[model samples]
Target: MKGQIMDKKIIVLLSGCILAVFLLAGCGNDEVSSEYNIEYLNKDKTKIVDVPYEPEASDTDGMIKEFLAKLSSDSDNVEYRKPIPNGVEVTDYSLDGVMLSIHFDADYSSMTEVEEVLCRAAVVLTMTQIPGVDCVSFYVADAPLTDIRGNIVGSMNQDSFIENPGEQINSIQCTTLKLYFANETGDGLVEETRSDVYYSSNVSMEKLIMEQLLEGPQTEGAKSAIPAGTKLINVSVVDGVCYVSLDENFKNQDYQVNEAVVIYSIVDSLTELSTISKVQISVNGDTSGTYRDNFKLSDMYDRNLDYVVSLEETGVTEEE
Candidate 1:
C-alpha cells in the first residue's frame, strides 16, 4: 500500500510539471504572435495601406532589418505595392538615439515627386512602428534628401504624414481662417474671414494657411501680397516661432505692396494661432540677406496689426 501511494504522488508531480511546461510554451507563442502593421503603397501607388505583420525578430536591431527587408521586397498580396522602387537600393543605415538615417543609391533621386513623397511616407510609417525608432531621415548619393523646391527634407516621424483616425490619407476637414491679405490699394493689410475652408487633414495648419495665401484672397477688395508661382518648401513652429520656407519665387516682389504689408500679412495670419508668437521667413532654408530690400529674412517678426485696415476703411461691412 505504501509503495502504491508513493507511486501515485510521483505521477501527480510529473503531471503538474508537464502542465507547467505547456503553459510556458503557450506564452512563448503568444509573444511570437505580437502584431505590428507594415505600411505599403496600394496598387495605384497613390495611398498607403497597413497590413498586419508578425515580425520574427525579438530585438530592436533585428526588427529594423526585418522591416526594411519587407519594405524592399514584393508584397505577397497583389493589391499592395512595395515601398522601395526597383533599382533604388539602401546603401547603409545607422541609428543614433531614436533617429534612424537611411542612405540610398543615386537611383532614389530618379523617382518622381509624388512617388518620392509616397515612398517616404510609407517608409516612415513602417519604421516608426519599431520600439526604438522615433524619426527617420533619408539620404541620396550621400547627400541629404531635398524637396522639389530644393529645401532640405528633414527628419520625419509619424506625425509628419498625418492621417485621420480610422480614415485613409487625404481625409478632408473644414475650418475657419482669419487670413490677412493686401487691401485694394496694395499698401495695407485687410482681414478676410474664410469659413468652411476644406482641406486635407494630412496637411498642417501652417502649410494650409500658406497655401491659401498663395491662392490669394477670395473676399473683394483684398489682394494677395505673396508673389504667384511661389511654392511652400516647409513650415514648422518651434518655441513660439513659426518658420516659413518658400521657393526662389518668393523673392519676386509686387512693387505696389508695401514690404511691411507683405511681411505682416504672413506674420499676422500665422500668429492668429495661439502656438505662434513670432514668424521667421526663409528662402530655400537660407535666412541671410533681406526680402526685397527692407525686411530681413533672419529677423523674427511679431504680429503688427498697425497695417490691418478696418472693414469700414475698405468700404466693407461686417455681417452681423
Candidate 2:
C-alpha cells in the first residue's frame, strides 16, 4: 500500500509539469507568428517584428514618419546651381478609406496661399484614381484650405469633365486654370506641352499698378507649328513662373501679333487664372529689345488695345 501511494503521487506531479510546459509552448508560438506578419523592407530583405494588429494606414503613421526622415536625409545632398526651389512641405496626413487629406505649408513662394490647396488636390486626384483611393484634400499651413475665390474646397461630387484649349501660350493663369480643371475633374489635362509662352491673362481682372509677369510657351503644341527639328534642352521656374530654353528653332518664321494681341495674351492669361496684377514677354531668354516700342509679330503687331491702343484705327484690321 505504501509503494502504491508513492507511485500515485509521482504520477500527479508529472502531469502538472507536462501541463505547464504545454502552456508555455502555446504562448511562445503565438508571439512568433505575430512577429512574422509584421515585415519591413530594409533596402532588400524583409525584417520581421511583432505587432498587435493587422496594420492599416492608422498603423502606418510611424512608418511614414520614418520614411520621410530618410527622404529628408537624401534630399540634403541634392545640389542646385540655380537652386531647385522647394514647394510647401507636407507635414501631416489624414486617410479615411479611399480619401487622403494632406496638410502642407506654402510660404516657399510669395505667389498665393490658394496654390497649396490646389496643388494637394492634384496629388490627391492622382492617388485616388488608383484602385484603393478615390479622393484627396488638403490643409494649408495647418489652416483650412480655400480656392482662388476663398471658397472651401473638397472632393468632386459626381464625375465632371474639364476642358483644355490645347497649346495656346505659357501663362500661369492658363496653367493655373488647367490645374483648376484637374482639381475639378480629378485628372491630368495637359493637351500638348509646347515651346511658346504668351504674355497675357485675357481672363483676369485688371489693375492700375501691375508687375510684368511672363508665361511658359506651349512646349508640346509648338512642335507642329515649329520647325520639325527643335527639341527642349532645359526648363526653369522662378517666382511661380516657368522659363524654358530651347536649342534654337525656326526663329525667322513669323506669326502675327499686334499690341492688342501682346497685351491680351499676357494680361488675359494672368487675371483670369490668378490674382496677378501685371505681365511681361521675352523671346528665347532675352526680353525683346523693341517689343513695347511698336508691335512686330507681323500683322499681330498692328491691332489696337483698349488701354494701350484705342479702338479707333491704329492700323490693325478686323481680320488682322
Candidate 3:
C-alpha cells in the first residue's frame, strides 16, 4: 500500500509540473504577440483599406498566421474569399530589405483560382503594411507558388493587383491633374494641382481624372463636390465632349454647397485634360436628370474657372 501511494504521489507531482510549464509557455507566447494595423479589402470588396488587429505572435510568421486566422474567421469587417485551409501552415519566412518570402505547407498548392487571388491579395496588402516590406512572394514545398492567372512569375506589389481594384495594389504612374475642389467656405471651388497615379487601363485619361474628382481631393484645404457614396458609372468622349455617368448618389445632397460650384467642379477639372473640351453630366444613366439648381444634365458645359476661389483668400478647408 505504501509503495502504491508513493507512485501515485509521484505521478500527481509530474502532472502538476507539466501543467505549470504549459501555463508559463502560454503566458510567454501571449506576451510575445502584439497589435498592429493591416489593410484588407472592404466588406463590399470595393477597396483595399486598413484596420487594426492584435496578432498572436510578433515575429513575421506569427503576425501572418494571426492575419490569416482572422481572415478565415471573419471576425473583422473585411471580406475574404478563401479562409486559410485546415492543413496549410507557414513553414518559414524571410525578410531581405523590402521583399518578404513566405513558405507554406503542401496544402497551399491546391488553392482554387479565386482563392489564390484573394489569399495573395490579403497576404501582400497585410504584410507590405510592415515598415520595411514592399513586396511578397509565396512558396509551397520549396517551389514557387502560382498566382491567380496560373503564372509562376515571382514578386508582386500594389500594382500587381491594379486590374482588380479593392485588391488595392497600385501600379500607378505619377501625372499632374488640375482638379477643382470646394474651398474652405464651401461657397466656391479652388484649383488644386494634384500629382496622382494613373490607374486605369480600360478608360481614357479624361475619364480617370473625372473618377478622381469623384474620389475627392487629397489637398487639406479642398473638399469634394461629389456627393458621398457616389460612384462613377461610365465616362465617354466624342469630339472633345466628355459624357459622365454617375449613380443615383449624385442626385442627393446632405450639405449645402453652391450648385454651380459642384457643376463647374466637374467641368473645369475634366476640361483640363487635352482630350476633353466640354462635359455633360448624367445621373443613374439618365441624361435628362436635372438638379434643383436649374442646371440641365443634358447641357454640355465648358470650363468656368470663374467660380474657383483662391485658397490664400479663404484660408479654410474641409475638416477630415
Candidate 4:
C-alpha cells in the first residue's frame, strides 16, 4: 500500500520488442488479528532468585485471553515486513510501555541483516501502534537474543542494531550456532559458516570461551562445549549428572539453535572426559531444571526468578 505497490519485474526484449509481465498480488490472504487485550498487574520488579509457584485456581492462559481483548482494531492495518520473508511464532504480543519487556520465539536463530532490519521495523511499528509502550526490548524465552555467530545481544549497544549487525549473533534459541564467513570473493553476505556450538560443564579445571567455542580454530562443526576461560562459576553435581553454572554473558534469550549447538558442544567435548550422560542448565546459579531460555533484559530476569522462591510441601515459601 506504500507508493502504489511496485510492479513485479518479468520483462523480455526480443527483436527490438519489449514485453513486461506485471503481477499484482494482494499481500493479505487472511485476516490477521488486529489487536490484543492485556491485563495490568502490580508487580514489585525487584528480586534475585528462584521461587516455584503452585498451580493457581486460574491458569495464565485465561489471563492471556483477557489481556488480548484490549487492543484497538479500527481498520485492517498491516505491518509490511519486507526483505525478511516471514517471521515465525515465539511470544505472541508485546506491549511496549506496559511490559517494557518483549519475548519472541525465533523462527531461525542465525540472524542476518535481513533479521536485523526486520527487528528494527517490527519493534518500532509494534510500539508505535500499541498503547502503553514507549520503548521495546526483545527476548528469546528467558534469555537474551543473539547474532548469527552465537554472540549474545545484550542491551547497552545501539550502534550495531541497524548498522553492523553480524557482530552480535552469539546463538540461536536452544543453542543452535550458525557462523558467518566471508564468501570466496571475501564478501560476508553468503552465510556459509555452519557448526554446532557445544557445552562442557562437567570437566573441571577447563572453562569454555570463544577459543574453544568451536573446533579447529575456524572450521565449523560440533565444537567444544565450553568456551576457553569459561570458568565454572558454580558447580552442582548430583549422581551422574552435572548442573553447571555459567556467567550472565553465556546466557541469551534466543538460544534455540545455539542450544542444539550447546548440546552438541557439550556432548562432543566431554565424550573424551568420561562420557557423562545427562547435563542440566542453571543460568547465573539459579536451577529449576528450566530450559535454556531467557529474555532481552537478562540482567534482571534472575532477580525476578528469585522473587518466586520455591514452596515446600507445606505450601509455604522458602528461599533457596
**Model 4 CA RMSD to the hidden true structure, in angstroms:** 22.8
lDDT of each: 0.77, 0.31, 0.63, 0.32
lDDT of 1: 0.77
| Per-residue alpha-carbon lDDT of candidate 2 for residues 135-171, written as tens digits (9 for 90 to 100) | 5565668766665435576653112111222322211
The runs of at least 3 residues in candidate 1 whose Cα sits more than 4 Å from the true structure, single-residue gaps closed, are: 1-34, 163-200, 204-320
Residues 1-320, candidate 3, lDDT per residue (tens digit)?
A: 12221121100001111121110112123344333444444343323333445665766656656665564454333242224545677787787877988888888878744344445666675666554667888888878986432457498765555454332123223366788988757788988887644333334687778767877777787788877778888888999999888899987784567788888998899998888889998996798757655789889999888898886767764343
Ranking under TM-score, best-scoring first? 1, 3, 2, 4
Total clashes, candidate 3? 4
Best by lDDT: 1
| Candidate with more favorable, higher lDDT: 1 or 4 | 1
Give the best candidate by TM-score: 1
- Tens-digit lDDT track of model 1 for 56-121: 997888988999999998788777789898999999999999999999999999986556766887
Question: Which 10 successive residues of model 3 have the least lDDT summed?
Answer: 9-18
How much does candidate 3 score in TM-score?
Answer: 0.48
- Compute the lDDT of residue 199 as modeled in candidate 1: 50
Score candidate 1 by TM-score against the native: 0.51
lDDT of 2: 0.31
Across 154-177, the per-residue lDDT of candidate 4 in tens digits comes to 532122222223321211111233
Residue 283, model 2: Cα distance from true site in angstroms? 48
